[model samples]
Target: MAFVTTFSTSLRSGEGSSICGSRPLSRPSQRKMVRIFMAQEEQLKRAEDRMKKTVETVKSNFNTVRTGRANASMLDRVVVPYYEVDTPLNQLASISIPSSTTIQIDPYDKSVLGDIERSLMEADLGMNPNSDGSVIRLIVPPLTQERRKEFVKSVKAIAEHGRVAVRNIRRDAIDKYKKAEKDGDMSKDESKTNQDLAQKLTDKYVKTIDGLASEKEKDILKV
Candidate 1:
């Protein structure tokens, strides 16, 4: 009975050691998988961030296009020469839309009013600046059919550029993973999976850009 009990005890000890040995072996592989996943996630996040920025840029550009109504954002691109340094128009003045078709600019410093007026004139926004010494007024005229069509075309071009930028970011992200696979940092299957994810992200952002463009086009075409 004693010998039989000793044999059973040895068997249980062997089993426990085997399990412990396997734990050490698996730990490295588990850690490696975690690292790989984190790297892929980081890459995807970076790509998405860039795509979002591109969309925002397209939105900002669309805002700069003149509509029939008075929008303060239409002067977003205007730069005034303040003390020999070029500055954004919004920084130098308080712009208000008191009416549907008039943009009023009130400068804190009256001395810079003339500079602001000249800058607005040079902006070529199809509006003349009427400055009465302390303030500048821009009368946003109703856009003709031809002018509206032109603005629509411009917004379309901007949307296309944004789409192209998103696609470029996707390509760059895919290339990074492919190179990782080539360097044996990841498997081909992993690289392919990441590439597919990048494509999906691109498609989503491109769709968003299209939507923004459609909205801008409608705004420009509205009488």
Candidate 2:
């Protein structure tokens, strides 16, 4: 009976040692998993930021497209040679909508009035700039059917570029995870999950670009 008790005690001690040994091994693995998760989150954040900027760029480009109405934003792309430096027209002038069909540009420096008018003429906006000494006036014309179709095509192209940019960002993020999995920094399952997330993000931004494009198309064809 004493031998039996001694054997039983030895078995219990062995079990306790085994449990304690497993704790140290598990701790390192748990910390490694946490690190991997944080790294993936950071990558996703960067991808989202880039996608947002792409969306904003699409919006800005859309603003530059002409509609039937007069919008000051249409001149957002006009650059004038001021003091031998190419400068944005908005920086050298005060642009205001005195009427729905008129865009008045009053240059802070009267010397650059001619330069602003010349830039507007060369901007391919299909409008003539009328300079009256100190200010330039632009008469916004009604867009014909053919012109409206052309503007629609332009906005569509802009949206396509934005979608491509977003997809590229997603691809880059997924590639990072693939490299991580290859290097054994993360598991295959984790890498796949991150790639799926990046795809979902890409889809969301692409939908946003489409919406913006559709809205601008409607505006152009509204006349």
Candidate 3:
């Protein structure tokens, strides 16, 4: 009888906690809440990591696209031949911008200057490369109106790829959340909340990609 009375008193105290701005939960229920929170955190972390990578890829792709000014990053995608093996152009030569319109390439080994020049022309970057057996100069021409429009299209495509990557991550996270709910780890309401959080993450990254595209387009279109 004494043990029963003690247990009843504990329940009464817990019930009154809500009036004091707190509520006591059973040990099993507390564990369940913690487990659900951890699962949601894991999903959010995965989504964030995936979205960050996508954003970086978009930035890299933008660098590969040329702007009006001479940029070393324009040569980021150029491949050069080093001893019959394909290599990045930067490895074979030191690149610098001596002027706004010219990219100067000084080969560490003089023999590769010709090969590097030929590669630049073939890359179709629309720049003429001139070499005098020592240093090579690439003159970046002003973009024609038509060329600028084409570049805008290319940047939009790259941004779209980033958005798709982020959306795929959101889809995977939501699927995992739903599966956990089905397996009885959380309630339907909890699963829905987690899914909403993942969707918000997706939306945020998509907006960032759109902003990147807008800025790049503006840069390309600006005279």
TM-score order, best first, reads 2, 1, 3
Per-residue error (Å), model 1, residue 182: 0.9
Assess candidate 3 and give its lDDT: 0.85
Tens-place lDDT per residue, model 2, 68-167, is 9999999999999998999999999999999999999999999888888889989988999998797889999998999999999999999999999999
- TM-score for predicted model 2 compared with the true structure: 0.87
Question: Please, what are the lDDT tens digits per residue for candidate 1 over residues 15-104?
Answer: 322333555324445445456666777898999999999999999999999888999999999999999999999999999999999999
lDDT of each: 0.87, 0.87, 0.85
Candidate 3 total steric clashes = 0
lDDT of 3 by residue, 1-223 (tens): 3433454455555542232366676656654555566656777787899899999999999988888989999999899888899999998889999999999999898978888988998889999888887999999999999999999999999999899899999999999989989988867987898899898999999999999999999988889
Q: What shift in Å separates residue 219 of candidate 3 from its native position after superposition?
A: 0.8
CA shift at 2, candidate 2, in angstroms? Answer: 55
